[model samples]
Target: MTDRYAVFGQPIAHSQSPHIHATFGRQEGLALDYRAIEASPGEFLAALEAFAAEGGVGANITAPHKEAAFALCTTLTSRARRAGAVNTLLRKGDRWHGDTTDGIGLVRDLTDRHGLDLRGRRTLLIGAGGSARSVAPALLDAGILELVVVNRTPERADALIDAMGEPGRAITRYWEDIRELGDFELIINATSAGRDRAAEFKLPLSLVNSMTTAVDLNYGEAAIAFTAWARSAGCRNIVDGLGMLVEQAAESFLQWHAVRPQTEAVYTELRTQLAPLAGED
Candidate 1:
């Protein structure tokens, strides 16, 4: 029988997961099937249980369901534990193992695809939500000189720094004080502020310079505002989350199939497909 896998999310019609995974399976010569399952809010657990009952061995959770998926896990990898969220799930016998590969995905995209050196770089992460939490430890492990987290909610940012267990290396600042926080070599927007066109958030132009790399953990329409701001602010390297999306999916695929897929081809193809929709020329 072919191995079964899927990605779960609400409003999932636009997901490229099925295509990405199918391409990966073909590259590795593995007989498998992957699809996107739309689960309504408050229906994720039920949807997941039903998938597992049908022999689904693994699945990817996105957006509003990642924390819920973490709650349903029988076991968690260290990364998931640190992130307080789970994006990838692997079933072993009757139990599900949860892990978050988002961080590794972002790191890989930056270092391997973009050729950006992260070692000992001062990095600023905007937001303390699941996206930021998922990538914090990975950034630290990558030898960042300092990791500064700023969020609208100061307490939540403090909590995330506490959980990362590197107080000396990581610190939290209020979003309003971002200008005072000084510039960074890398700045990542981990918040969902860009998801809505009317969502108002302040980004300090002083935080970015010609050499700074600005990344938003969102893609397509959700990333347009930040990307535009970064460019106008003279940031030479502005990247959306498309690469991270593919890289993370690749990591999850590796976890399920024990094989790593080359990401350049899939990423290029997906970018081209999304270009028209995203207003890219």
Candidate 2:
């Protein structure tokens, strides 16, 4: 029997997990089947249980479901516990194990794929949601000089900072004060605001210069506004989250199969597949 896996999210139609995992499975010559399952809010746990009952060996959780999955897991990797979010789920015997590969995914995409060194760079992270929580510590651990978080709700940002152990290297800034903070060598968007087409939440364009690399933790239509804004601001390197998606999926695959698949080919293929959609944006 083939091993079963899936990815779960609320608006899950756009997930590339199944494709990425399928590529990994093929590369590793594993008999696996992966699918995308849309689990609306309040139904994630039920959906997860149903999948497990039907023999799902593992599943990836995204967006609104990460926290719920974390809550439901009987065991968690240290990264997931630190992040307070879970993006990968594995079944051991009858128990579910949770882990988050998002941070490592983003780090690998930026440093390995893009050849960007994050060490000692002054970074600005936008948003204080689960994505931010998952990636902030990883960025700090990558040796960033400072991490400034700006969010609509200052308290949430503070809470995230607190959760990350309130490292002296990290601080929260009010969104309105972003201009005063000046430029950041790297800026990352961890919010879903772009997905909803809300243009009112603008970043300080002056924050981006020819030297800055701007990254949006979203891909396709959801990343257009932020990437376009970065481009308009004279940022030479603006990246969407597709590479991170593929890299993270590879991590999840390793967790389940104990095999690490080469990601360059998969990343290139996915980029080619998304080219038309990117052009449309």
Candidate 3:
């Protein structure tokens, strides 16, 4: 059997990881089996173990599983250790090694692909979930002037800041305090804001300026709500997560296959396929 790989998370049927990896494999002319497996928190470890036992050589973790996957790893890369999360997992014999590519993926997409300067940009991150945790330190390291994190649960936002060990640079605000917060250079929605009719998606437009760049760390249907909100607010640049997704998937592929695949073609194809879905916005 070809080496098997997969992405594991709840509500994962909508994930594009399988397709992204298949594209990467095709570009590299390698035969690989990559699939999306939905697993709840309770069943994640067992599901991972089963996959590893059944020829799974590598996997990507998403959402609620990043932290859990971090805990389950036999070893971790420094990036994974600092982020307190893991989104990429590699099985070596019986040991699973973990790393996080989210921050790098996000930064590259925003900079290399989107042509934005991260230095001195005041950024507002709108969620404190696993994806947020995975990307926060990266944003800070990318030379943002400041990072303000807000979540519906203040303590969680505070915890995320505390975890970053950048008390001087990263701060937390209550969701209600967003109005008082001044405009930001960058606004990132790292939550599942569009998947449900979450009140959190309804944000104050005062937070943006003519040059503000709005980014929803979600793509497709899950991105519609926040992207719509960003558009109505008149942000200068609005981006969904597809580019970040491709960038991160490429990083994960490099780890698993020791080779990098071209991303522009894959990203373009996926973007075209998702064009019809844009009508949802």
lDDT of each: 0.86, 0.85, 0.89
Residue 207, candidate 3: alpha-carbon lDDT: 97
- Collision count of model 3: 0
1-281: candidate 1 lDDT, tens digit per residue? 45689999876887888999989888999867798999986888889888988889999988868778888898999889988888999998999999999999999988988888899789999988788888899999889999999988999899999989998899998877877998888889998788788765457778976678888888877887887777777776878889999999999999998889999899999888777322121
TM for every model, in the order presented, reads 0.92, 0.94, 0.95
Ordering by lDDT: 3, 1, 2
lDDT, residue 56, model 2: 89
Candidate ranking (TM-score, best to worst): 3, 2, 1
Candidate 2 collision pairs = none
Candidate 3 lDDT tens digits, 1-281:
56799999989988989999998999999978899999999999999999988899999999879999999888998878878899999998899999999999999988997788999999999999889989998999999999999999888888889988888789998888889999999999989868885534678889999778898898887888888888788888888888889999999999998998999999889999888333122
Which is the leading candidate under TM-score? 3
Better of 1 and 2 by TM-score: 2
Candidate 3 runs further than 4 Å off: 197-200, 276-281
Clash pairs for candidate 3: none
Angstrom error of the Cα, residue 90, model 3: value is 0.6
